[model samples]
Target: EYWWWSLFIVLAGIVLAVVDTLTGTMGMFGDSGLLGGLFELGVIVPSLALGVRRLHDINRTGWWLLLVFGFFPIAAIGGGILLVSFFLLDNFLILTVLGFAMVIGGGILGLIGIIVLIVWAIKQGDTGPNKYGPDPRMATSQ
Candidate 1:
């Protein structure tokens, strides 16, 4: 169920993006227009909710989603700032190396996190609810 809902959300986002691009309302790269922004705003809460539910289904804490989604982006952003600082500070060698390390490490870890989530989503949820709540499967049947 989580996998299916996640797929639907992704597909819907893709379709909206394509429509926005084709209609010249937004650019494919960066120039987001009203429609694109609205779509993003609309989906953000639901996407998070779905993610939390999915995590719950697996008997994992919803907090895992935060680590999965937040850590990498924050690291990458911090790395970017460092990289920019290195340039502004007359090419500090240490800053350059540290920035590169953070950015690359963040990206690699982010990819691994995504892959792990994907695998978990594919697996069966806890047999009879180890925690979080009752079995979603059982709930639906009644």
Candidate 2:
């Protein structure tokens, strides 16, 4: 159930984003466009709630979602900083090496975290609940 919901939400968001991009509207909400912004605004809370619930279903804390989502942004920001450093500190071989290491390492770790989250999302919830509340499956069964 959680997997299905997550998949649906992702697909819907993708569709909206694609539509927004293709339309090329000078939307008040910037590049996302009107529909995209509205869709994002409407779904953000529910999506986060669903993500948290899905994590809970796997006997994990909601904070795992933050870790999972944080990876990509942190990686991108680190990469951007490295790109700037490459320009400003061209003479420093060590900075370039460290920058490459951080970008690559962060990207790899982010990909691993995403894969782990997907695996957890597909797995069955803990039977009779280990933590975070009663088993959603059992709750529905009764």
Candidate 3:
């Protein structure tokens, strides 16, 4: 139930994004100036709602999504450190090499972070229930 709704919302958001990208009118109700704000409303809100369901399914606070997303910057910092170390070594060719490497490394870390969020979402919650509320999985049985 929740999973289906979440999927629907995500797909809808994606569709809206594509349409907005192509038409530049943001769903026939927005202009370029408003696209950014409209995108947030049309996409981010429902996505967050789905995220809430995802967290609910896992017996976690949806607030943790922020933490999970925040991992990207932390990962980028680690990459930045590696980049600085390479730069400090005074190898110009390798310095440039490290820059691209850090970009890819950061991208990989961001991907992994998103994957972790998805995995966290699908993981079965407590057998019955925990702090979040009644088990979404068990709501059907009861």
Candidate 4:
């Protein structure tokens, strides 16, 4: 359910973006619409809601979505900042060693989080009720 909804929302966002570019209405009623924040109502809100529901279907907390999406980019940016600080301090060798370590560690963590999310999203959901809620399968049958 969420997978499909997300796909559709992403497609809609792309369409709106293209229309905005062609029409010179760079912010109207869509992703970045003339209506300002109202634009995100169609794109980000539904997508986020679907994503959260998707996580719930797998018997996981919606917070997992935040960790999955945010962990990598946040960690990687922090690592880059650390590396730049090291360079500014004139610690060349420390910059090389620690910067390399930071980047690699961030990448590893990011990859791990992505893999976990992939598995959680595709893996068969819980048979009945586990934690998040009742099995979607059962809900459909009734």
Best candidate (score: lDDT): 2
After the best TM-score superposition of candidate 3, give how far the Cα of residue 49 lies from its true spot, in angstroms: 3.8
Instruction: Give me the runs in candidate 3 sitting further than 4 Å from their true place.
Output: 13-40, 61-63, 73-105, 137-142
Measured by TM-score, how close is model 2 to the native structure? 0.75
Candidate 3: tens digits of C-alpha lDDT, residues 5-64 = 777766766776676677666535544224544655676777777787767767778877
Give a tens-digit lDDT track for model 4, residues 1-142. 8677757666776776777778777755444745333456646766777777777877788887777667567557757767676667665676566666666776777789878878888887778887777787785653
Runs with alpha carbons beyond 4 Å of true place in candidate 4: 23-42, 139-142
Model 2, span 29-49: residue lDDT tens: 875677778877997888789
Per-residue lDDT of candidate 1, residues 26-97 (tens digit): 764466555666777887898788888888888878887777777598667868768686768776777777
Which scores better on TM-score, 2 or 3? 2
| Top TM-score prediction, candidate number | 1
Q: Which stretches of candidate 1 lie above 4 Å from their native place?
A: 28-33, 140-142
Q: What's the C-alpha lDDT at position 136 in model 1?
A: 78
- Look at candidate 4 and give me any clashing residue pairs: 27-32, 27-33, 27-34, 28-33, 28-34
Poorest stretch of ten by lDDT in candidate 1: 27-36
* Per-model TM-score on C-alpha atoms: 0.82, 0.75, 0.52, 0.63
Error of 2 at 81 (Å): 2.2
